[model samples]
Target: MARTATAAAAPRAPGFLRAALLLLLLVAACRQAAEENVVTELRCQCLETMKGIHPRYIQSVKVTSPGPHCDRTEVIATLKNGQKVCLNPESPLVKKILDKLLNNEKWN
Candidate 1:
């Protein structure tokens, strides 16, 4: 009976070791994901932006302010052709569009 008990305990030692190692790996993976989240910019939607796009080609505009995912403001425009493009916030054309959009005035 004692020998049988020892054999059962020996099998459990390897099983316990495997479970502990798996838990350790899971923890490390979680830590890596948390670190990636902390860096930000990974989730920023805009990859390329443009300037000097005429407002007449734009059907609508959406503005996103700086947040945890991005450090700079983003201006996205939906063109009349149903395509989206990122606009440069520093561009004079974009500023004028923003003014027209915010003030709800007809674009001149």
Candidate 2:
């Protein structure tokens, strides 16, 4: 009787664990999607608040241009703390840092 009871519970244990893990993964995916949307909205409004790179916080950058002119370019930076900022892609300082990132240079 005892052996039969343990065997029945063993099969259900694995299934229960799998269901719990899947639910956790689903929750994480939803959280990330919502955070990305927030980042996009904040980045769009960066022109008013962001003046330059928070050097210590910068994680990566993306460049976009409204026209052929460099002056029209926008550099969107995703910071280490998950904040995003938009700055002039034409700036020499920004260009240097961007070049380092793009070139895959080793950190000093």
Candidate 3:
């Protein structure tokens, strides 16, 4: 009886740890997905805003949303010349334009 009880408790300990790890992984994945969504939305907005002025200037786009101290969003555009331009979503100029282009009801 003592041995059987110890065996049952051993299995339960690993099962509980596995469950906790799975939950932590799931939370991390959800946070990453949310950040990616925000970046995608911002990139689309930037592309649309730049379309008229630059036409085909933007060759590629990369977005980074760093943690607390850094800005919430950073968008890097690769130009035809292999040069890159970084745009901070927190910047005044970027915020103004994005607000006009993305959040405005007129664009819809």
Tell me how far the alpha carbon of residue 54 in candidate 1 is from the true structure, in angstroms, after superposition: 1.2
Whose TM-score is higher: candidate 1's or candidate 3's? Answer: 1
Candidate 1 vs candidate 3: which has greater lDDT? 1
lDDT of each: 0.87, 0.72, 0.59
Please give the ranking of all candidate structures by lDDT, highest first, separated by commas.
1, 2, 3
For residues 1-108, what per-residue lDDT tens digits would candidate 2 score against the true structure? 999999999999999999999999999999999898655432233354245674667877787655433335577889898977777666776777778888988545
**Candidate 3, which segments miss by more than 4 Å at Cα?**
40-108
Candidate 1 global lDDT: 0.87
- Score every model by TM-score: 0.59, 0.45, 0.36
Cα deviation at 46, candidate 1, in Å, is 1.4
Number of clashes in every candidate structure? Answer: 0, 0, 0
Q: Give the TM-score of candidate 1.
A: 0.59
Clashing pairs in 2: none
Give the lDDT of residue 22 in candidate 2: 100
Highest-scoring model, TM-score: 1
